[model samples]
Target: MFGSLPLGILQLWHRKFRLLTATLGIAFAVILVFMQMELKEALYASAVRYHEALGYDLIMLSPKTPHIVAARGFPRNRLYQAQGIKGVSSVSPIYLGQAIWRHPSEPLNRRSIFVLGFDPDDRGFEKLLSPTVLQRLRLPYQVSYDRLARPEFGPIGQMIDEGMTVRNQVNDSEFTVAGLHAIGSGFAIEGSIFTSDLNFQRMFPERSASVIEFGLIHLDPGAAVEGVRREILDALPKDIRVLTRKEFAQLEIDHWSKATPTGVVFGFGVVMGLFVGAIIVYQILYSDVQDHLQEYATLLAMGYPHRYLKVIVLQEALVLAILGFLPGLVLSVELFRLTAESAHLPLEMSLNNALTVFALTLGMCVFSGLLTLRRLRSVDPAEVF
Candidate 1:
């Protein structure tokens, strides 16, 4: 193995251009795979963030909903079932839906916005806000919105102050912006205006309050979540599914991974990376074995075992893998960062992900080395000369 490392390095140096090309191929594949992983995280994070921003530990939705990340919606009526579970503390049934907010008073500024209906006086409501929010809480009907999405909405705390009731001109009802809250919005929905359940349902009366969507449940301190989860699941009717925080999160993530085009596209990239790596590594190693057939034959003629040649090839392949994967990984980190910043999406490069890449790269090298076994066994000094 030791001897083979120098031999592999020397050969790679001799075929610098080919090595460069193969390395570039590997890098491109790694970068794409990394991007997909990041997007998956973002998709999951965005959904969790929406709920988590409310400072809840467990989220219970209508039984039929697979996960929040997928196409998720409920009648806003099922929020009642989760409100009575044991070990449960504060519970707020929320009505989440969308409607156009025509700032009748502002004219030209009418825009569609998200509607979150929660009790401002609910016991757990204070846990859900930032200091900025607590300060704005005194303002009637105030809500949070992200600055990045609504640059025109003025600064946080700035009153878009002068607006008439939120007319779901389509539904023909009205609500007013208490103010906006900043839980954030990106890719999922635009952030502009927000209002409390009292105001929200009034404007969108065509919507329901008791027909609340999902409920955010807070577990009593030191409680057993698994036991509590099973009890909750067993208690709920089949029409609704119950998931613990982690299980619910995973389900949502898997649903998005399987159902979305972005998921499919990224999956293909990972497969292609493995395929390209195998092809390039196999062709190069096989060609090198054939080129050096004479030298291998001479060694065999001098009583070297055929297995020695195989060992040398395997070692060389491994060394090449380490050589290539190290640089590819380092470069991938930087490339992923640049892609993330420009794309404005989270592209996480987790340790597990990197290790998976490294393992795949090494597997490709081993596979490529094995392709030379038959040729190595048949080498003859006469044939080479």
Candidate 2:
């Protein structure tokens, strides 16, 4: 076994140029797979940014609402009704809408932004917005801009940080940037604005306070979330849907992963990367095997078993897998960082993703090695003589 392993290493080392080419090919595949998986994970993670930010035990929304960004208003009375439920501490109504954000410096350039409206005193936003910012949002026509918003939204966050009074048109109404928050942007939402419900209505006069987009329910201490969720669902009408905070977040994730084509596209990219890697490795392994058929035949003629020869090819694959995965991992981490900084996305290298790509690289190389075994098996010692 040891002898065959050395032979396999020697075979690859003998052709340093080919070995380098094969390692680079595998590295390219690793990078492709890692980038696609990271983006897919970021897509799901970013989709639930709002849900994760909200401090709530239970959430209520209209059943007609497909996702938080596309929320349909439910009667505000539902919040009052949920407040009367046992084990309920409080309920806060929130409003969501899309408005054209006129660039502060470029008036002609506009982009759609998500707007979230809630009461200033609502405890549900305590985790997301500081009390001071919430207080500032209480004033009409004042809104907090998301600091992680895409750069296309302009330098509103920078101006706010410099203590400048930044004002811009959100729809037909001009709103002042009172503060900045850190809820990042996603595929569907380029930027976000937070304002009090009063200001939200001011920006969209057609919407009524009686109709709100979401009802955040905070359960009393020691209240079971699942039990409270069940109670809320039973108490609410068919038009309303009740979910735990985790379930609410999952709902948004599902909408993006299942309801849209983005997830499918990313998944397809991963498959294509694997396919490309396998093909490249196969070509390299096949060529290496063909080049050394005479040496392999000599070994076979010496009574060496086919299994020993197989080990040599597999050993080369293992070496290639290791060499390729290291650089790919390093490059992927840097790319993830650059993407997170530029796009304001939640892209990062996780332990699971790293392990997954490594496994795929190993499997891809090993499979290629197995394919080359056919060529080795057909080599005739007699024909060589």
State which candidate has the highest lDDT. Answer: 2
lDDT tens per residue, model 2, 59-174: 88988888888888889998899899899999999999999999999999999999999889877888778788898998879999998899998998889888899999999999
After superposition, candidate 2 runs with Cα above 4 Å error: none
Judged by whole-model lDDT over C-alpha atoms, candidate 2 comes out at: 0.90
TM-score of each: 0.77, 0.98
lDDT of 2 at 247: 85
In TM-score terms, candidate 2 sits at 0.98
lDDT of 1: 0.63
Across residues 1-385, which tens digit of lDDT does each residue of candidate 1 receive?
5755676667666788877776766666556555566666666665555645565667767766654423345544444555577787767666676656554445456566666656665544564455555455445445555433443333333444444323223124533333444544445554534446765656576665566666777789987777777777788666555566677667766666775676777677777777777777777778778777777888888998888788878876786677678777887788768855554445557899888888888887898889878788778877776
